[model samples]
Target: MESTEWHLTSFVNLAVLTFLFLCSQGQVNGDCPADGRTWVPFGQSCYYFVHGNEDRFKSYTIEKAKEMCKDYGLLTVRSAEENSFIVENSLQVWKGGNNNMWLGMYYNSDDDEFKWNDESHVTFKNWEEGDAEDPEMPLIDTCVILHAASGKWENVSCSEQPQHGVVCETPQIRLQRKNASPLLSALVVISVIMILGISAAVWFLQQRKGSGSTLFPSFEYHPPFRAPSADQTCLVEAEEIDETS
Candidate 1:
């Protein structure tokens, strides 16, 4: 019985220790942000290709496109790699006539320079040669387009040109809700394990008690049956002998 109790206690203790060890080594989920609709991650930012509706196959002007991207983020671009990322993804979308998409850049006649909608410096330009300048209509073509065939930028009149697609860019930060702390999760698991262990211990003790095999058996005092005294025995024998005679 003692050995059985010792084994059970050892098992429970080992379970508890194992639970604690695993809890201490618990890990949280990865920190990568969740991907959004049509959004792809490249480097430290996310890019989305806003596809046109099926029926109309519509496109947006530069101003309208910026307004569309307003809820999520600004129409933006920075690097050649970023531009390429957008172009490649946008190519996957079903294209209509020109297959051109609006870029966030425009010609600034006042400054005689090209600038992004965010007013960032244009370090990278993928413009096709002889594009962005028209001898016939010099300053009219202010907006830029990513030509579908060549994946190069072309200057076009924003209003005169029919609507096209737009690319939306935002930083690759966690889009999902923050996870609970690893320590807190571990503690919760540990608590569950402890509760189960305690419940098991209680069940085992109850089983032992039900089977009349408790840790401490109750003791009752009862004097042993006493033999007859020598004088009593002798008198009984004499009486028996006299009666027989």
Candidate 2:
């Protein structure tokens, strides 16, 4: 019937709307960047793809670039994960000093090794040819980043300050109470309970005091809590004699 058809149509529409709402609430997996910006959840990084070299800002030194990111609770770029995130966003932002943007990894001259500031191994690498060839490079040092235009990796001097594209080291969240141990958690719980208990006690006392009426009341004190000695002794003695008789 026509009525049955209308009811089914309404049910289908309701189901579709509910499905859409739930889909939007959860994160999308393997999805491209949303809007003009790509959200790199893995690195907690957001990259904005800019076409050509038009609107790029003046390059900053590694330290200065780091400060800028830090101002926004972000850090200078570093690491392959971050590099991939930037490329995915397709932005030509400056890294390092003048031309190179700062990446997360840096070269350790003392150890003569390419090490991630995050302590992760550089198992994967994508370097450009004729790259990692800084004349002043240390024998045992190598930082990694994408080529300015090609988004390829190259080794550069860690000490050399550049005014180009640079990556930031994402700030790591340190569980300050990491070593707090179970005793610390217990102490915190006990302290909270004590505070709540004290507050409750104060509230109870205030309520009790408010409910009791002592205002405008008169007080008469009697020693030993007995009435005046008018004839108490005589009455007691007479009563005793009568009892004996």
Candidate 3:
């Protein structure tokens, strides 16, 4: 009896463990990717963030890139957590390569301040190397990040144009407009479909009617079988008499 009780307890414990294991696996499956990536949905664009590789290339000036992202309804790379996540995952992306890329920041000479494309103040400075300096031309005041091994922030004189990779920001207007007024659009589509269906039905009925008339003409005046006339009767009687004679 003692041995039987021990076996029953052991079985219960094993079943509990199995249930727990299954529950853990279920939780894992329901969670996000194990690689520490997140999904971003902005405008018509969808972005995935994974950490670790920074050796890709798609160069553009920061402003131009921001405009491009805006056109596609996306934002610039502005999150430290996201950046760190990407770094941790060792994911390669276009804007995080070896070359000095343009961020969504520029030096505004008129205002004598660093301004973001969104007209925000440039408080966050993370430049890399020999940037934002032109001893000969003081008027060439612009902000750019250095791409040296140190990867420090530097202020340098922006020349005519630099073909650098860019981090972009899509404008809010575009995203707000995308897929907006869905109910009305859907209603319009449904109405059009209904109209087309009704028109096709009418056309099909008309065609069927036309084909029926052609295939079987309607005879409105059908003649009936008539009895013989008086002349016909006299002729018949004369023929009968001849035959008898």
Highest-scoring model, TM-score: 1
TM match of model 2 to true structure: 0.38
Which 10 residues in a row give candidate 3 its minimum summed lDDT? 26-35
Candidate 1: tens digits of C-alpha lDDT, residues 1-245: 66557657766776787667555554433232354466676777766667656633356777788887875554455677776666666656544344677777767777788887667668877778877566655564677778766778777776675677776767666444455687976787677677667766776776788688867788999999999999999999999999999
Cα lDDT, all candidates: 0.69, 0.51, 0.49
Q: How many Å off is the CA of 234 in candidate 1?
A: 97
TM-score: the better of candidates 2 and 3? 2
lDDT of 3 by residue, 157-216 (tens): 456556554433322222111332657556655665565566556555566675565534
What's the TM-score of each model vs. the native?
0.51, 0.38, 0.36
Candidate 2 C-alpha lDDT tens digits along 68-134: 5452322234456665566644342432222445565666666655566555556666667766555
